[model samples]
Target: MAEIQAKDSGGKGGKPKAKKHSTKIDMTPMVDLGFLLLTFFVMTTTLAKPQTMEINMPVKAKDQEEQSQLKASNALTILMGENNKVFWYAGLPDAPAAPGVQVTDYSANGIRKVLLARRSNKDLMVLIKPMEKGTYKNMVDILDEMNITGIGKYAIIDVDPRDEELVKKVQ
Candidate 1:
């Protein structure tokens, strides 16, 4: 709705004055149209699907002896430490003649490269162990790396005492 109000001013000193008008615009329709468009868009638009990574964890064995043992040759153990430091070693940490522990980071050239290099081996298994001082983000980054490298067999595990010793020696 709109309206115009006119004011007529009589002549001053025998001269006629022009009429002045003020216009008022109603915004009800504009508001209604805005709401209608909002509702239409809200009803018509589709929400985006959440981005997520799928993980499959192994079932636990009831008996201690029933648990399957991972082969030393097929294993790559990654230890997450404070300050974004990452330590890795092949095979069991306590194995006789265990491979020397090496330090790396979460960068594309660091752990990602190591995982990519070992991705050719179908039997490759990765054990991710987060230390006491490691951040939750560190775990997430390692998991992301696993996904990026397409490493199929991996586990988030507790750090063993021997593994801690190895990491301590490295630090």
Candidate 2:
């Protein structure tokens, strides 16, 4: 509620005139109502839960050499390093004069497009080799890309000395 007060002041004709009082608004109820609505919304609304990508890792085997083999053409090797550097190539690193690594970024038009293009080949596999110089975030981002591309045949492998040498040459 709002009210006004008046003070008598002398006018030009010596007659007393009403002086307007400054406005004073009591916002106690308004503030209370605002908090009440806020509490109600907070209590009644459902918060979105954090989502996670499902990662399928290979189980440890006593005889690692017994694992099934993948064709060379079916493999794409990713080498991640600091400063947002990504070097990718086809076939194994030990292949005779293995394919030259192509430099790319993690953007939607970069690695994402590359992976999507390779999606056409169901038999194709992705091997992620994160170098010692690579950041943890780089690994996570590449993993996210794998899940986004719906790639079921991907593995996080250690950096081979030969692959490390290739990264140095490309970077």
The numbered model that scores best in TM-score is 1
Model 2 TM-score (2 dp): 0.73
The sequence of per-residue lDDT tens digits that candidate 1 reaches over residues 1-171 is 999989877665876777899999999999999999999999999999998888887777777797678888899999999999999988988677967999999999999999998888889989999999999999889999998998878889899999888887877
**Candidate 2 on 36-141: residue-level lDDT in tens?**
9999999999999988777767779998999888888899999998788889998888787768989999999989988999999989999999888789999889
- Local distance difference test values of all predictions, in order: 0.90, 0.87
Best by lDDT: 1
State the displacement of the C-alpha of residue 31, model 1, in Å, after optimal TM-score superposition: 1.6
Error of 1 at 62 (Å): 2.2
TM-score of every candidate: 0.83, 0.73
lDDT of 1 at 93: 80
- CA displacement after TM-score superposition, residue 23 of candidate 2 (Å): 23
Candidate 2 has its poorest 10 consecutive residues by lDDT at 1-10
Give the Å shift of residue 27 in candidate 1. Answer: 2.6
